[model samples]
Target: MQNAKPLPSYLVHRYHGWKATTWTENRAWYRRLADEGQRPRAMVISCCDSRVHVTSIFGADQGEFFIHRNIANLVPPYNPDGEYHGTSAAVEYAVTTLKVAHVIIVGHSLCGGVKGCHDMCTGHAPALEEKSSFVGRWMDILRPGYERVKDLPETERLRALEKEAVLVSLENLMTFPFVRSAVEGGEMTLHGLWNDIGEGGLEQYDPTTHKFVPI
Candidate 1:
């Protein structure tokens, strides 16, 4: 901590802003949420992109959604190997402990992590391909999704893989026994979403239509 810098001035200003307006307006709701504990109705798994604000995008109040973020927003297939799994642990807690009724995997355009994975796989970024690359290994979860969209034009592959990341995560979510049980028992629902950051548009995956439709 000796070498660590103080909090950014901009963040300090933003916190003051939130405390003044957003927090003040929802003071009672915030207090109630604190006293009663969080009972979020939904769990959202999304990318760790700075531009993606899950709560703001959904217009959710404090403690309304349990969110888990990771590179490319990809969820690895359920693996109980007695190893550290942050995202899976969050999902477990959300489903089994929090009893969330819905699970949403939100993917977005121009995701750096997804782009890195694409570059790594296509030999565009050799550093990420190295075995020692932590990000490279984590992004490997999206490899299957990339394979599904590999044939698209160079310009379009990235966008296709972005959606594929959501699809893969949705499929991976079912691999969790508790998640599958809840979903099958009609206690929980799963959703996939893709957002176009530049366009400010959202698309939801429609299983019946097997497509991502504008919502």
Candidate 2:
């Protein structure tokens, strides 16, 4: 096996800076979290985008949110196959064990994952169709979302499908028995969010309006 590499000089400097500031400032709270274990009240499923800061966006403190970031922030339909299901496992742990009161699917504008799905489905990215593309396979979850927006103007479909990613995830979350039970029994709630990367605007999905409204 290869040995782990050392941190880059710039990252090491940043780490030291944080350790002297934010970390030292919250040393006790951090220790308390480690001692008592995390009890986050919400679980956030978001994209793996560098600009999407889940915690900073909510002004949340440590242990405030249990976040799971994936490509396009999707949740697959419930499957009980004894295979590696990273997203599903996180959801199970968050809902059943953590007993989080809320599960939020947060999508964002100009998501490369969403773009990849768009390119892949539209015959633009042939490499994604191969069995070897992890991203392509993972993005397959958004295929249905892509279909829903296919009829729209090609120019407008990507943005529409980005929101659809959040909607699709909300629907898939219900496929899990525990999630469905908790949501239906009023013990837990589900939410969908779409964030504008450049504008910094946040929108919450409104089932009644069937649209994303400004938050």
User: Which of the numbered candidates is closest to the native, going by highest TM-score?
Assistant: 2
Writing each residue's lDDT as its tens digit, candidate 1 over 142-188 gives 99999999999988899999999999999999999999999999999
Q: Candidate 2's residue-wise lDDT over 45-161, tens digit each?
A: 999999999898999999999999999999999999999999999999999999999999999999999999999999999999999999999999999999999999988999999
Worst 10 residues of 2 by lDDT: 1-10
How much does each candidate deviate from the true structure in C-alpha RMSD? 1.4, 0.9
Candidate 1 lDDT at 184 equals 99
The TM-score measured for candidate 1 stands at 0.95
Q: List the residue pairs that clash in candidate 1.
A: none
Give Cα distance to truth, residue 95, candidate 2, Å.
0.4
